[model samples]
Target: MIQLPYPRLNVIFEALRYEALPQQELAQRCDISTRTIRTDISALNDILASYGAQIQHQRGKGYHFDIYDETRFLDIEKQTKKMKSSPRNAKDRMVYLMMRLLSQEEECKLDDLANQWFVSRTSLQADMGEIREQLEQYNLELISKAHCGLRLFGEEQAIRACIAHILFQFKPSDHTFIDVCEYFFPEINQPSLKTDLLELINKNHIKLTDEGLHHLVVYCGVALHRLKQNACIHHVDQPNLSEEAQKTAAELSQTIESLLGAPLPQAEIDYLSIQIAARRVTGVPEIDTQKPTEQLELTQYLLDYVNTHYNYDLRNDEQLKRDLLCHITTMILRVKYQITIPNPLFDHIKRYYPLAYDMTVAAISHWGKHLIPDGEIGYLVMHIGVGLERNFSLEEQLPPKALLVCDSGTSIVRLLESQLIRSLPQLTIEKVESLRDYEELSKVDADFVISTEKVSQKNKPTITVSPIPTSFQLEQVNKLILMNRSHPYMLDKFFDHRYFSVLDEPMTQGEVLKKFSAHFTEDNITPIEFYDSVIERESITSTILGEGIAIPHSLGLLANETKVYTIISPHGVDWGNGKIAHVIFLFAINKDDYEEAMSLYDLFVTFMNGKAVDTILGCHSYDEFQYVAKECWFNRKKDW
Candidate 1:
């Protein structure tokens, strides 16, 4: 029998499941390219020949699984089920090795593991190197003795935390508790344990987010596994807990004891209590007397930092303050204890809310007290993103007003008014007047005029349309409204021909930054410290927003004058982590213009969409750049 790779097997499964699938659809389902799918199908046909089956492809309809011998096909199908159960790649092998080592106290020999997994010892050792790097972040070490092989050496609590982190590391977004538990804890009854834990949490009025609940349940499973091995956390400092928290801890310990059929030690119980407190959602008011002064002060400092640096005055938002207070209080605990709580929506949050994410990163980096992980940063971004949304709503300016002139009767005027309102809600029609009345008016109070007849308005811009406006007319109105907005002014204000450059040579990120910084400093646009600040900001988090685009700015407003240096790297700069930036926008913002510069982020967000960066990269001069940018902006008017 021919052994098919995992991706090829997935393609086969999808083809068999569907009657007929398009090549594009199959590629998307398998997360591969259409070219790869075609190659796989060709290879699969050869392999399936021995099994009395083949994958038939049509021109438009993609691929279909045809079987001539049911017995042979069934044999291969049964083998695929077994193949799916084992580790398929290096990442999966590393996970399997981590779980095996963490679950047992005995030393694991690389040669033995290599034989068991049908791999070379060299390959297993390379995987062990990566595993060691990951474990170091959790304060755990992998120690190897000459004769005894390799063993994991860490505190019992840290070990268990590592176990929980590993289990949730690559968890799918749609994976259930049972799916995760059954894979990681095959010997334990996870369904029963989950039921007992859920009931106990409800009975005790314990507040945990769905994510928090999942974390607690998985921690309990790890605890049970360690306790069964007679390896327990001992001699740890008892955390300071409130009276209510102590009672809840006692109840939780009892529930665990009943499930384990053994009494937990005081140290283990204290550790468990700390976990619960870390994960628990507090219901205390924002101004509760028990609220820690340090956390409140830190939260206030964060808000002030964003307001001063980013020109977003969220300091006065009471709800934002409350949310930040609650989240930061627990976040500090998680950071202090090195606990890992995965943020499942971190990617989505970062992608959709780049400005908010960048603001959160900058604010936290300015705080400079703790080395907060990306997961915690993601949670902070959510809070700050909502606060920004609230601020935008409250301070949003009114739409452009337009006057309507129709030659028809009252019925036609009414119909045009309704149609215009439905199509362009952002546009306000001040009044409706006939062409003669519009001509007779001395002064028009509206910004623009929309008319059904071809009439000229000297004061305001006039747009001619049918009584019933077509889609093109509506689009023209929308484009006009968007142009009247801050987008065009923003483009002209920051981007300039003097500051734009096209680099055809290959360079590193540092070289590009240094070159841009030198030019700015020599021109007296920015201070010498600007380069260091930009480097510091990048060190905290790379400003790359993906899709061959990067918006690099300093830690604070360090420029003498606000300007944006645009660089188009045709050969691509080697950004760290294997990312390449084909278009770079280095912002040098001054403190005086910081308030008006807030709209700059929106312009960058617009360019981050589909093919906008590519279109901008293709520009050879400032004129071309400006044209392509305005085109991109006009196309994405609805996003604003």
Candidate 2:
């Protein structure tokens, strides 16, 4: 039941003194026209929609009101009694109660509800009329179906968001401290934290509670984040620390060990100390603070970015401010290495919230005044396990300087240099110096001295393997270079080759030739080339293996054990004849076959087809390649 505060509405409502009968019966009993009663029914339904209720008509029965109220507005009056109450307080209060009842049942006996509210049924009906009007604006619907319960269903997350809205309205800003603390440290005032903290604090000389420790950490994270924002990654120094800076470090160290149960790494400790010092110095606002001025413009840009760039929708309301803050926090902590998120959480964020992470990167670079480029960049992690296995190809970065030392003068050095430069693309020969100038070697800033006859330049790293270091050296050296600080985690990313195969994934030239010799021949021997002439012939084109496969191999593979590899593609790849299915190999057998075997690659493709070829390609690992060669390549099938 609702109070009909207005006198006119009250009089009209009470006028329905004899309203016990159904619509037709009531019209006859009250001596009103049935058409007039119908008019009343329609106007009454409209009023109920204003109150956030819908009136539905059953086939054989009279119409009933279905109120839509997911907000559970029953407590609106209690919430609104505070000083911040809105002018439309009365209506919102009515909406709240209606919402609660709507959650219960689609239709209840009007007499029963009116009795609970201590008002007449007519008064309750008048209130339903008010709810019906505002239903559309709120994106709600009121349906009256046969015998089913009423539900306020639209978006469940949106419905729950009303709780956040209520907190915004009546709850004081002081509660934001509670909210932030709960987010960062959910266990602070929580029963478990409180109990555990109390037990620990009792052992200390001074009294401390869970809330105290939580607020300290929360403030520390905020302060530390601010510190990192100011300290430039490559240039931060320790001379600019204040007294309070020193205190936060000591406290953080103790808390990390005592409270968090994890000892702080020395590197993290130094970084945090620097940030704490930086936060005390006042300087430019972080990247996002200084802006292009228009408030609405910035908001709209954020909205568009959120909607289009990300998979999830961002809140368009004032709450977008909070989302922006979260983005900033995540970016600053991650980019500066101030915090290391758990590995699994990192994977989840990377997978599901890619745009969030992207936004985070932009926010960090923009605010922190860093030049980290933002885009779809990929990282490579390179490593090699065996002496004979070539793990990587180089030619990406300008190679380190090298001094090629052969006993001969410039002619011998130039010939060896030409051989290396042609085949080993990454190695850059700085100079070809004579053996007598070994004392002058100290002057050359070369990374390595590559030589046959060893000269003494102990300061420079030397790789002493003929004119050619093995292919494994090339792979290992490149991987080693990637591990240095200049590459920034490059060696931590694409280091996995176990999942790739010649039959499965397309590969470089060297993998194919090495693979075929390792399998097709009984000796499992691959030719190794020491000069440039052997490699130049095969670099011209591909060798198609046939039947939906192509192995574009290099004569470089037959040169050594490390150059041996297998590459396969089942999609019937192209060579120059419009298409090429497969290539068995490009073999290098000493200096003679290495140059002459370019003709052998074209001859192998004409005879293979179907399962006969696939069985050759299906070998899982290196050892199994021998089995595939014996069974499929030789037309004899056997398994162990």
- Give a tens-digit lDDT track for model 1, residues 1-640: 2345553564455455548788767764553446677887887778788888888877877788788988887887676455444455565677778877787679989888788767788988887777888788878888889988888888887888788888767543422333435666776765566687778778777788877777777788788878878889986676676555566667778877886789999988888778877888985464553655767877888888888777789988888888988888888877877778888778667656877888888888867788899999999999999998888653666788889999889999999999999988888889888889999998778867899988865655678999899999998887768765644656667778999999978888999999998899999999999999889888988788766788888887889988999999988887786678899999998888876776777677677753476577779999899878777777787665
The whole-model lDDT of each prediction reads 0.78, 0.39
What count of clashes does model 1 give? 0
Best by lDDT: 1
TM-score, one value per model: 0.78, 0.21
The runs of at least 3 residues in candidate 1 whose Cα sits more than 4 Å from the true structure, single-residue gaps closed, are 1-80, 120-122, 170-184, 258-261, 286-292, 392-480, 638-640
How much lDDT does candidate 1 score? Answer: 0.78
Would you list the clashing residue pairs of candidate 1? none
| Candidate 1 similarity to native, TM-score | 0.78
The clash count for each model shown is 0, 42
Q: Give the per-residue lDDT of model 2 (tens digit) for 1-640.
A: 2233433222223334223234554343333335555666566555545455544545555444454763532233343243122112243335334534333323545566456545576765676655655443335556654555344543322222222222222222333334433433343333443344334334432232333344323334433332232311232334434455455565555654454445555544555454344222222233354554333333345445434432223433434443334333333322342222113233233323322343333322223342222211111000001100122222355665677778766666666677667656666778766777766544556666777686675644455555554677555444333322122111112111332355566644454444454442434343333223223433333233334344333322344322223444554344543444543433333333332232222223222321344554555564464434323322311111
